[model samples]
Target: MRNPISGAISTLAARPLVRSALTVVTALSAVLFADALLSAPPAAAQQGFGNFFSYQAPKPRRTAKKKRQVDPAATQRAEPGKAGEAKKAEKSGPTQPVSIIVSLGDQHASIYDANGFVTRTRVSSGQAGHRTPSGVFSIIGKSRWHRSNIYSGAPMPYMQRITWSGVALHAGVVPGYPASHGCIRLPAGFAPQLFGMTRMGARVVVSPSDVQPVEFSHPLLPTPKMQEVQVPQETATQTAQQASVELASADVSPDKTAATETKLLNPIAFASVLKKRAVAEKAAASAAEKAALQAAQTAGAEARQATTDLDKAEANLKAAEAKAADPAPVPSAKVQPASQAPTDTGATPSPEEVAAQAEVAQAKAALEQARATKAEKSAAAFAAVEAYKLAAARAEEAGNLIDEAERRSEQVSVLISRKEGRIFIRQAWKPVWEAPITIRDPERPIGTHIYSAVEPSADGSKMRWTAITMPAAKASTSSSRDRKKSKTAEASQAAVAPPETASGALDRIELPDDARQRISELLWTGGSLIVTDEPRSPEMSENATDFIVLTR
Candidate 1:
């Protein structure tokens, strides 16, 4: 209020200072309001995203458990109770040791037991041409009633069947030799006892010879003087004394006694005996010499006859060879030209008629050309026939060689039968108990047998590793089971880890390639994936994983 200019300057300064202070306070208040707004909870957080921004600590995770695997070998073993039952069944029977001997030579059967020989009976064997085989056999089965198809309504008595086929030993009239059509015929009366003595699975040996005779060469004839020796008769008391003496001397060598006896014999009588023997020997030698000479003459005559027959045979062979080598040649006819001049001199043709005749000649020339063409075709057909015959002969020769090779490589089939858990091997349809182990395939079908080398699966769960599709009619119950088992095994093998390579996997499997190809051809008429060399899509390529390649 003192000076106006100074007051105004002071006022301006004061006003500026006040304005600056007010700005500071307003900026501070705005900053405080912004902080409060940022601190408030989000609306989205209340709707279940609270943990998205929040930092709550995570709870510990629970551990997972692993599954256990089952053992296959332990599962395959038979149960204990069943095994005990099987053992008990095996021990419950009183086994009878019965035997039957059939002689192929006599065509008869003889039954025997521990007691002694049961009975001897007549029998009929195979036949004249189909002779019953000579070998050891065992009774495979027994039946009360049996009949023969080949024989006229003949009822087999005490029918003890030996083979699976109709072959058996039963009551009938024994032909004394091979007469029946493979059945061993027995005498009607002895049938009951024979049947009673034999068991279902008794051993039967049908051999060529039952008893073999001992043989020795005859000694030289005794001398007449040695044969004539006689001792004087003695009283019983004296004989007893002599016998005692002989018994005491019996310990001495027999050679010494023989020498003494020869010495005691009269030399004159011995000489006479030797002379007679020499005469007889001379006569015998002379007769043998004459007989030998006659035999030589007869042999010479036979040789001459044989030579004549051989010459005739050679002539016949030569004729046949010539016929085979050179076939008869066909005769051909020659064509002759028609006569130019007419035989009828009175008839003369006009110009028009002569023109017509000329045209006819031209037509005949054309027909001759056609005939030549036909002749050429006939010749070609004949040549084709000759070629076919030659080819057929070659094919026949190849077939014969194949047949001979197969015959040479023929092996006997080893059949195995498993009844009540026991195994048996058979050769030539006859059972062999002591058969070689190498010939037997333990993993083959339980009832059937085979001789070929059958390669089982690598794991041995299936009988054959390779797939063999047999005809439906020929399939047995066991074979059907085997096929099912093979399929299951194949599925199991497929379930295993995929093979290292596609080809390697194919090798482990069996597929009918030919049949599959045929089916593919039928479905895709024009072509197939196997035949085409085109690239496939991923889906199409996946099909290769399932494809299998089988080799013979």
Candidate 2:
């Protein structure tokens, strides 16, 4: 008979409860391991895990095999119209990135989606006095029923503002030539359609010169430090239903119905707290720069005055030395104090000689003091200059940041915090929503990652972005050959890797059911997702831009 004790042990080990417990423990370990991302080094962007990423490598195209040369007529007869039908059925990417270009010379505008060209149309530009400025710009504002305050309350239907000074693209009369007040006038129905499709923060390149984006590799793109600043959010005034109704019955003529409700969002609320903070930071930076410059000027003046004092002291010292060097009057030197007693043989010095000696000592002291003062002044001036430079640099950086923020004010962004182990969704500096997230492992090596949306599906339902994964704060690097070997090894190893381990891509993150539902609804182009090991700073209260602290 079999041993009953051994049979009991085997039965217990095979129990479903025991296996389920083991699975749970394994999952817990994975979460701990993922947390180590911040403490580990990352690989490069191209092969394995990298701090930066780019568009996914395109699928390799299949090459048609060659056959023996045959008569053209024979080939045509064999295939008939079959080849042309096959070509018609070919399809490509589900969606592509959206970019726009406007050319003044050609009086034309073109839009490009990810795969290739999309739309091209003629446009009317600015007139003589109100010439449209040509430069690269981003669409910062859009309105269905907008009226210009600069002009005599002229109605601008389907207006899209590109500049702060009221330059826009709108539906107006395109007289086949330049004839607008610094605006690009589009065709009637096309404007509303484009408006519906276009998202906030879309690039609008207006160029006097002929230019197009081309693919070129360079070291300058992004590696050691790379990031794109985004714009803050804006609030809408009208309810969704109201907007839908107004847009349906659109009119831009002066005689249009005044009863038509036009939307005007409150800028303060519409603009995200992040944008406000960015503006405040930029202003503070400017003030700091000004103060530093003033300080530097004052110190410089003090330094110059010290040098002048030094010169005077040196002159006085030189005069004293000359008088001391000269042979003293023989008679004066021989003279003795008249009060001296005849019995006293020792001679006393005259008052004139004593005064001269004292004078020399005084001059020497003055010279030393002046030298010391000059050194101090010089040091102060140098320090002031350095301080000014640092302040100015900070101010300039802040200014640049604000400009970026304003330009990107309508874009979407995602924030991931290792400290909270949660993810946040933002648009134009406004918080859309937030969700609790978990990493694969909390104890293993993990690093900060960023993913940016560069392409969108044709229906704008799905988004595809590039990833950037940086090593932890303190991570080591291996040899080039070792890194290459690691990449190859990683590919094979990744097949067996746990799902918790991230690739720094959009899919790397796990969202709760609620968050997932939101993503499906609000997906758009050119969005950014940032993952950091840092916590949300305590100082980031109302009117504070979160980007500032993240960059810091």
Candidate 3:
């Protein structure tokens, strides 16, 4: 026995339309409670009418866990393993200079904070004709809400642009398969988290496989110079020997001061050679250009002469044709004398008239010869013009090479090879010296590393360098289980420590005394240092220094 008013209210709530309206409102409220990637609100905040209608998707065997749903009415729950990861993330705190690694083979992506690995998740990359380009890149642009300009304005939520030509990572429906048109499709839930963790200039390395950093030790690691040994002398003979030395008559050694002076002057001498070479190249290019131009002019003159000849031939052919059609009258005996009896004026053509026909035939033959000559001359003219263009192109190339070589000669540069793992220095196009250097993790992929020494004080001592590390496709990610027990304990300390930067004094390099002294002496400002996995190219070594090499 319920009250009539209560019964009426219950009836209204049971209606489909009323329930649907309430569900929409309930879902909107749930969204308001959860906005961050790593956080969630209280359960009480989400207690609403939306749960009355639960929608579940068909689950795959391997992925028995629920898929991320875009349904607004659904309760946004974190994955089972996510809580532990979130706790780990909280302990690590925010990462600076973040880096992301995407693997095509695994269909996965990982985030590396300034400290170390943060999180990893699955992703869907390009499909079919739109294969994702694998390389090292930086996030150049961001859009919280964006639409594809190239794809019928399809919505791309939390878009992070990596390239100018429409390649990006964005929130979209991932069907556990390659399906996007070139862009990387991220999980609807994970995209928001990643978007929060990254900013412009954050590195994004896409590879065919997973790659991780490993610990490495080499001769380059900073270590104190070895100390000289001494033995205690207990005898007077030993003491006397140490105190005095016998002077030998043949103690004279060749003086190297002049050779050193000459070696120093070699740069000036080479500069003159380079200058002369440039002048000679310029002269050769000019000569080639002039020759081509002269040939073209000669061709043009020949062509003009041929054209005039053709015109004259055409006129001669016309005249011959007219004469053949109606020949000139020959003087007849009828005009000379009426008494000489009737002379035939109109009769079969005589031998002289036949000769006129032969002359007409000869004129036609000459006209045809002229036309053939004109065609040959026209072809020659076209060839000459092409030759001129080729010569001009050669001239321009020569000039550009000259300028580039001169500039490179003046600039200080370095070549680093992963194969050798050594740094080679060049100043004014001459090899100054070389030294061994250790990569932090030599076992893992070091990639191509470039360090550009920017804005230096007159001396190279007080200078800064910018670094870019692009790992190769074959690089691999190291496992934490592989690290030693002691290293694992140190990980916590390393996480809290500041990172080693590319610029400033490198405390890592352990050098021989002579090598260390040599490094200090050579810092003439405005130079660059390049390191790569690939060996230096012959052309580059011959002409000028080439920067960046991440291949093979």
Candidate 4:
């Protein structure tokens, strides 16, 4: 204040010192702040932060406890019910003897009993015209009065018919094997003995070949047949009436019993004993009605299936017919030759024969061409169908993604605008600076700009700047140098690239010496370096080579 000039100089000098001191303080404060920031624990370091508050200790693994042993007597007493069940099973075990072996090949049969076994005589099978069908067939029905269509229409002696459709094992001439039309013909006078050995529901195994022979030590004693044990006709009829009454009363109600018994008995009598049983005709009519109903249902199903298949076939046939209708160009030589062929003949060929020959030739060629075209079209159709399937799958996937995106968009609360200025800024005085931006959610801070434009909104909510043009100044030069350097670096990196092998090339090819020498000789002799053979890996022989390499 005393001397203004001196005071100004002194203040100016002190200003520099004060500024230096302040700079040091700021630097130190910055260092200390950075240190503090770096040294502090992470924000997520709190104990029991991640699922720890509600955490439960793992349960201890349980060890299997050894089972306590019980006494045999205690176990037996504990399950008294099982003892009764075992005794019942023992009582019911295999009461009747089952058949042991049945040979379809050797035409022999055997039966087993609790005491021993019994063998039967050989039998002939179905002849060549009607071979016996080999299969595991069960005895579904039996008839004692079985007859044959072949063998002089003779009544099968001692017949025990097994199959329902007329095949049976009966007394007939056994000419070694498979001599009868289709019947399992047994040896003469042996059918009765075979029948005696078999039960009503016994299993009969017919194998493709005969098994090892089995000897029977114990033979069954024959039972005598009752010759004079007939009752009076009236008594017999009364007994049958009583039996039918008992059958009618048991389980089935009287009306249902009458219906069922009538149904069973009528089929046999309707065809054979119609005069004897007039009432049975009504039962046969009911069966006939049921059969008609079944046949109609089956026919309807078949017709529906046939219609569907016919529709598809007709479509294919139309396509083929259309292709066949298109005329193919014939060569001039082929036409001339065909015309000459008729002239060369001494007599003029008949129009029919000429037409027939042409038809045959045309048909053969058309058939071949059709087959080829069909194969190609089939392949193309298969590929097209697969492509369609793939496209459909992709479209479905994209649709699902779009649906998910739309659902997510519904949950977001944000206003979106599509106006030009909402994304870019434009200026009047300067060249246009075009920048485009996408706002995923308008609620969040705007992300990086995509492209710039020149117009700005009226309210200054959006700006339009001129197209950015770099000034031809020091900055431009520096950027160009940097780009050149980057290019050079890229070129250098590319120059040091590893050598690539050809797709099917090999090194140190293994080939037979003879093949190698032959190939060399051929090449030396000015022959084309072609070797025709199948290709093999690891080693190439003369027989394995398959290509030509030509050189000038």
Candidate 5:
């Protein structure tokens, strides 16, 4: 209040100091607020600032304390009660070669043999980001007491590999959920059982949800080339045994022996020779049978004619003898026939008596000739019948040989890839042939489909086929839990692409003439054909397997 200029300067300086103090206080309050927010529960923080400042930590519930007391290891392994069930599963093993179907939704695997269902068991598949793929696969490799190559030597006992890319079914702790890193985990006891039941090349189908194999029928399904003649089951069995013995005795490298055998006993060449021989033998049998029948009929007729002639000749001879012995009672005793009667009684001087004697001799000779002719004809007929039977037997034997040759040849698998524009053939997991194919529309997806030749058709004119259509790419989100998953899962479900139906898939492919012919010639019961828009999978390694489809 003393000087006006000095007071104004002091006021400006005081204002700056006040502003600095206010800024420091505001920064301190902000730091305290951030600390409170960081300390609050995540749920409370998400609720908003209204609760953020006032949030209070609640006391733990009794149930929470109880849960903590439980053994943590229990959640990391299979249920203790399941050990007995696993043992039971191991005892009732499959009788035939088995196929496996794994359902991601249920986390269970169902096994089947050729006849039908075998057994089912719990499994643990891949978790979250490392989701296991879904598609038709095959057990390409197996190992007991195996160790993971990618996971720092983690124990993977009784591992059966489906893909060379780290995917397999192995023994591990099954915690009733998807806890694995890509491989399917089985109960400790069940794993060895499955390993014992399975073989390399066994079919394995993994899907989003549980899907059953239905009795599917279609006309477009490829049929096996029917043999004109069917060989008996007995003959086929005998042939198989003989072949097994021969193969077992051979002491040579399998690869070299197979090649040599193929050349020496070429199925095609062997079949050709057998077929020709069968046809010729059948024709010869038919001719012989017909000739034998005709000969028998002619001989029978000749024998009857000869018998009749012999009887007639004997009757004539008897009549002639009677006439020669007692010439006609010549005129009877009353009419001057005394001279004629006396002359013919002792001497054969009368012309009528001499003629009757010559007639008797001729009749006897004709009867003897007829009897000899009948005997000769009967013997000829018997010989002809025996000859016909032998010829028929020869024909049947030729047909059996053809059937045996065919049975010895393994059933072949066929794959038609629209993307590759080619058809591939494999037998015993080895490539046999390949040829170009044509798709109706190269841009359109044909979808993956597996067609199996189940058995022969009713009339036996062709093979009966059953098909299995693989799930679409987005099918992995099929489970209810997966449906309610994060936005990524929902997007995947929303982008579900429709897969082609089994019949429709077959209709799109246009096989070349040679391919069709080859398929017909090689196809057999249990043989499979795969048609898809994708090219051959990398998993179908060189001379290692049939087609391997992956639908992720």
Candidate 6:
């Protein structure tokens, strides 16, 4: 029913080429119309559709270049947190003995001197599996710009080793938590400062919680054996005046001399000197001891030889006496020589008898000579033996002196092991002595404790002690409420409570008289005594380290 014209349009639209031609012709006509308007005057374009259809291409961007410059000051300075570049040994630091306490609970470390607290800084301890052990340890070794032996040569600048089994304080990334491989990580700025302040054998107490050193005293604690100082003919004031005069003559300030004396009195400085002296004295004593022993052996051999000579002389004398007593019946007259005639009087002796008598006399003289020779040899041997004994005694005295020097030079370490039911003492990393000790109530746990002889009293008769008790490991069963309650109770407790607890431990312990005496004689400032429920740490090998007590 479509109209013929309409039919023709529909038929053309159905063909794709005819429809596309029509669309292009219509678009071209519209573009020509728009271009004509845009090219017209602005008033004409505004009146047309060109205003609504305006378009413009975007302009390209321009960038300015900068020239590079080098800064001399920046190049000379150490980069921030660069530990390797900061490796330096400070020439001056704390003069007295220093102690360090690391608290795993708060993740902080504090340094102390003979006087009191010095400083504290944040630290990063070990993570979950590789936990930093809680214990009383000492700085056994140190190195600058060290690398881990277990790990793949990871840098550990300003390393201060506490345990031989790889526990130490070193500079590394501290993420404010337990994140290290059983080592204590310190900040770059603090590590070098601490390293310079501390020395080998410095007591380092690593505990589960924060603890501080306090003035502690107990009757059972060993007191120093004070020796009387023998003054010279001149008084101390006179000696000082003389020294001042000498210094003045040398054009030196009195303060300079005083400073030199102070340096000499510094514990670390004098201790090192004493240690070297002790070693030399020990060597000399050993040589003297060996020589004296050899001399004794030689003297003993000579004594035996003299005895043998005496015996030989006695035998020879007896044989001669017997021959002389039974003078072979004067050989019958027929056997006698013609010149040898028997006298009628018994008083007159035969030539043969006279010859026998002369032979006996000669034997007597020879025996007497041998006796005198043996007497001289025996006296010489006795004298030599006495001389050896004197030498040996001198060597022993020298050894005792060396021991005294060593005790003064190095800190003494005492370990009271509840598991072993004994106490062990070490000096200069050597086993000085060990003895059985009785601990009351062995069944119940007494906990781990560290007591340090921080410094001597003004009178030098007693030492100021600081006690730190290790906290129990974090238990899954323990709740925050209980922890808080416990902490509150501890804080509220009387200050005397700490010293009582430490002294009470000493009361529970009973030492042999000799052990007590020896310990007293050796006790000095910077020494430490550790009481632990656990046995000796595996990190402690024979003659390799001080007493290592692992609380965990």
**Top TM-score prediction, candidate number:** 6
lDDT of 3 by residue, 277-387 (tens): 566677898899999999999998999999999999889878877777777777666454568766678878866568778878988898899999999999999999999
Error at 378, model 3, angstroms = 66
The TM-score obtained by model 1 is 0.23
**Which candidate should be chosen as best, given lDDT against the real structure?**
6
For model 3 the local lDDT of residue 353 reads 68
Estimated TM-score per prediction? 0.23, 0.32, 0.32, 0.21, 0.49, 0.55
lDDT string for model 1 (2-46, tens) is 544345446555655656777756655554444333343554323
Off by over 4 Å in 3: 1-85, 90-93, 215-552
Worst 10 residues of 3 by lDDT: 245-254
**All candidates' lDDT scores?**
0.38, 0.55, 0.56, 0.36, 0.66, 0.69
lDDT of 2 by residue, 131-173 (tens): 6665444566789999997998888899988765678899888
| Ten-residue region with minimum lDDT total, candidate 4 | 524-533
Model 3 lDDT at residue 398:
75
Q: Which stretches of candidate 2 lie over 4 Å from their true place?
A: 1-271, 327-348, 410-552
lDDT of 6 by residue, 1-552 (tens): 434444545655666774577775675566555665756566566656433245433344677867864332221233344323223212345545788888787787877777666667678888767978878888899999999998999999999999988999998887767789899998877787788888888888887667777777777778665432222323324435552211112111123223233111223223434455556666777787778778777877876777787788778778877777777765444666667966565576667668778877877787787778778777877777777777777767766766656555567788888899998988877788998899888776676777888777554566778776666554344455764554221222222222226666777888778877767666677777888788988898787788888866
Error of 3 at 330 (Å): 99
| 548 Cα displacement, candidate 5 (Å) | 1.6
Runs of candidate 5 exceeding 4 Å displacement: 1-97, 226-411, 456-462, 475-497
